[model samples]
Target: MISSIFFYSTAFVLFLIGLFGVLTRKNIIKILVSLSITETAVNLFLVTVGYIKNGKAPILTNTIGSIGMNNLKFVDPLPQALVLTAIVIGLGTTALSLVIAIKLYKNYGTLNITKMGGKR
Candidate 1:
């Protein structure tokens, strides 16, 4: 199986790429997309944080019979639950931001952030 380090590195790279896109891109829609990427990276990182090697689900089963707490190797569920909640919130925020972007485009006739307000 793949190690948690791989997941962590992947998440870090995604976050960096997203940050670069947000910082360097001029279009409002692209920035929103980058923000979504960053959100996804964060979610991935959170999930990775809860990983446990050789861990089983927290649920007790008859198949794993008579296992004591000291021998239990259940992976953490809190981070997974938090990531789920974050995903929902991120979806809502992304939709709201996209709607705002549409309104901005309608008003300015352009999606370029620098051009929206005319010459500086």
Candidate 2:
């Protein structure tokens, strides 16, 4: 229980920090970084949910389970599937964010969104 608490607490802290950055930061690059952080935290939390003691790989073959101890448990496939989709979507979002950031930098000469209207 202590390990579980620590793990979830860390995850919560990461998520909170990201949320704070996204909500309070003015820099466009900072916002993008924060968004990426939020994605990572969420993914980590999701993967944690599927964790099991003495977890074994999810293989359908009979050979794998033959030698397995009684305590061995298969990892939940749902979390794996969700994590994979999150990875793909995260990649797409990161690529698109970079492209947008590049375009913004080229236009404004700086990453600050507060000065987006042009220099004073």
Candidate 3:
């Protein structure tokens, strides 16, 4: 019970911190890092949500002899699968953003958005 609460709270706090960083930071690289942090928080939250106390993996084994699925306590797999996909997508997005940031830096010679905009 306590562990569950802690996991959820930690995920929420991480997400909030990432959001704050993205909203307040001016450097493109910092913003990309913030976005990755947000992705991590989301993935953690999803995995946490799928957790079951004292539950076994979603797999079948001979140990469970004649007992059927109705009697077994197995952790949900959907959230885990979704999180895996999300992780891959997040990696791709982060890579793309990094490439774009590199292009922007090469063009403007600065990673700061405001500075790139010709502002003082």
Clashes of each: 0, 0, 0
Across residues 1-120, which tens digit of lDDT does each residue of candidate 3 receive? 567788899999999999999999999999999999999999999999999987789888988646876788888999999999999999999999999999998899999988887533
lDDT of 3 at 96: 98
- By lDDT, the candidates rank as 1, 3, 2
Pairs with backbone N, CA or C atoms under 3 Å apart (clashes), candidate 1: none
The local distance difference test score of each candidate is: 0.92, 0.83, 0.91
Answer with 1 or 3, whichever has the higher lDDT: 1
Better of 1 and 2 by TM-score: 1
lDDT of 1 by residue, 1-120 (tens): 999999999999999999999999999989999999999999999988998999998788886667767888988999999999999999999999999999888888899998877633
lDDT of 2 by residue, 1-120 (tens): 345556667788889999999999998878988988888888888877887756677776677657665645887879889999998999999899989999988988988887888454
- The best candidate in terms of lDDT: 1
- Give the per-residue Cα lDDT of candidate 3 at 69: 64
- The Cα RMSD in angstroms, rounded to one decimal, for candidate 1 relative to the true structure is 2.1
TM-score of 1: 0.89
Q: Model 3: clashing residue pairs?
A: none
Q: Cα miss at 69, model 1 (Å)?
A: 4.6
Which residue runs does candidate 3 get wrong by more than 4 Å?
66-71
Query: How large is the C-alpha RMSD of every model relative to the true structure?
Result: 2.1, 2.8, 2.4
lDDT at residue 87 of model 1 (Cα atoms): 99
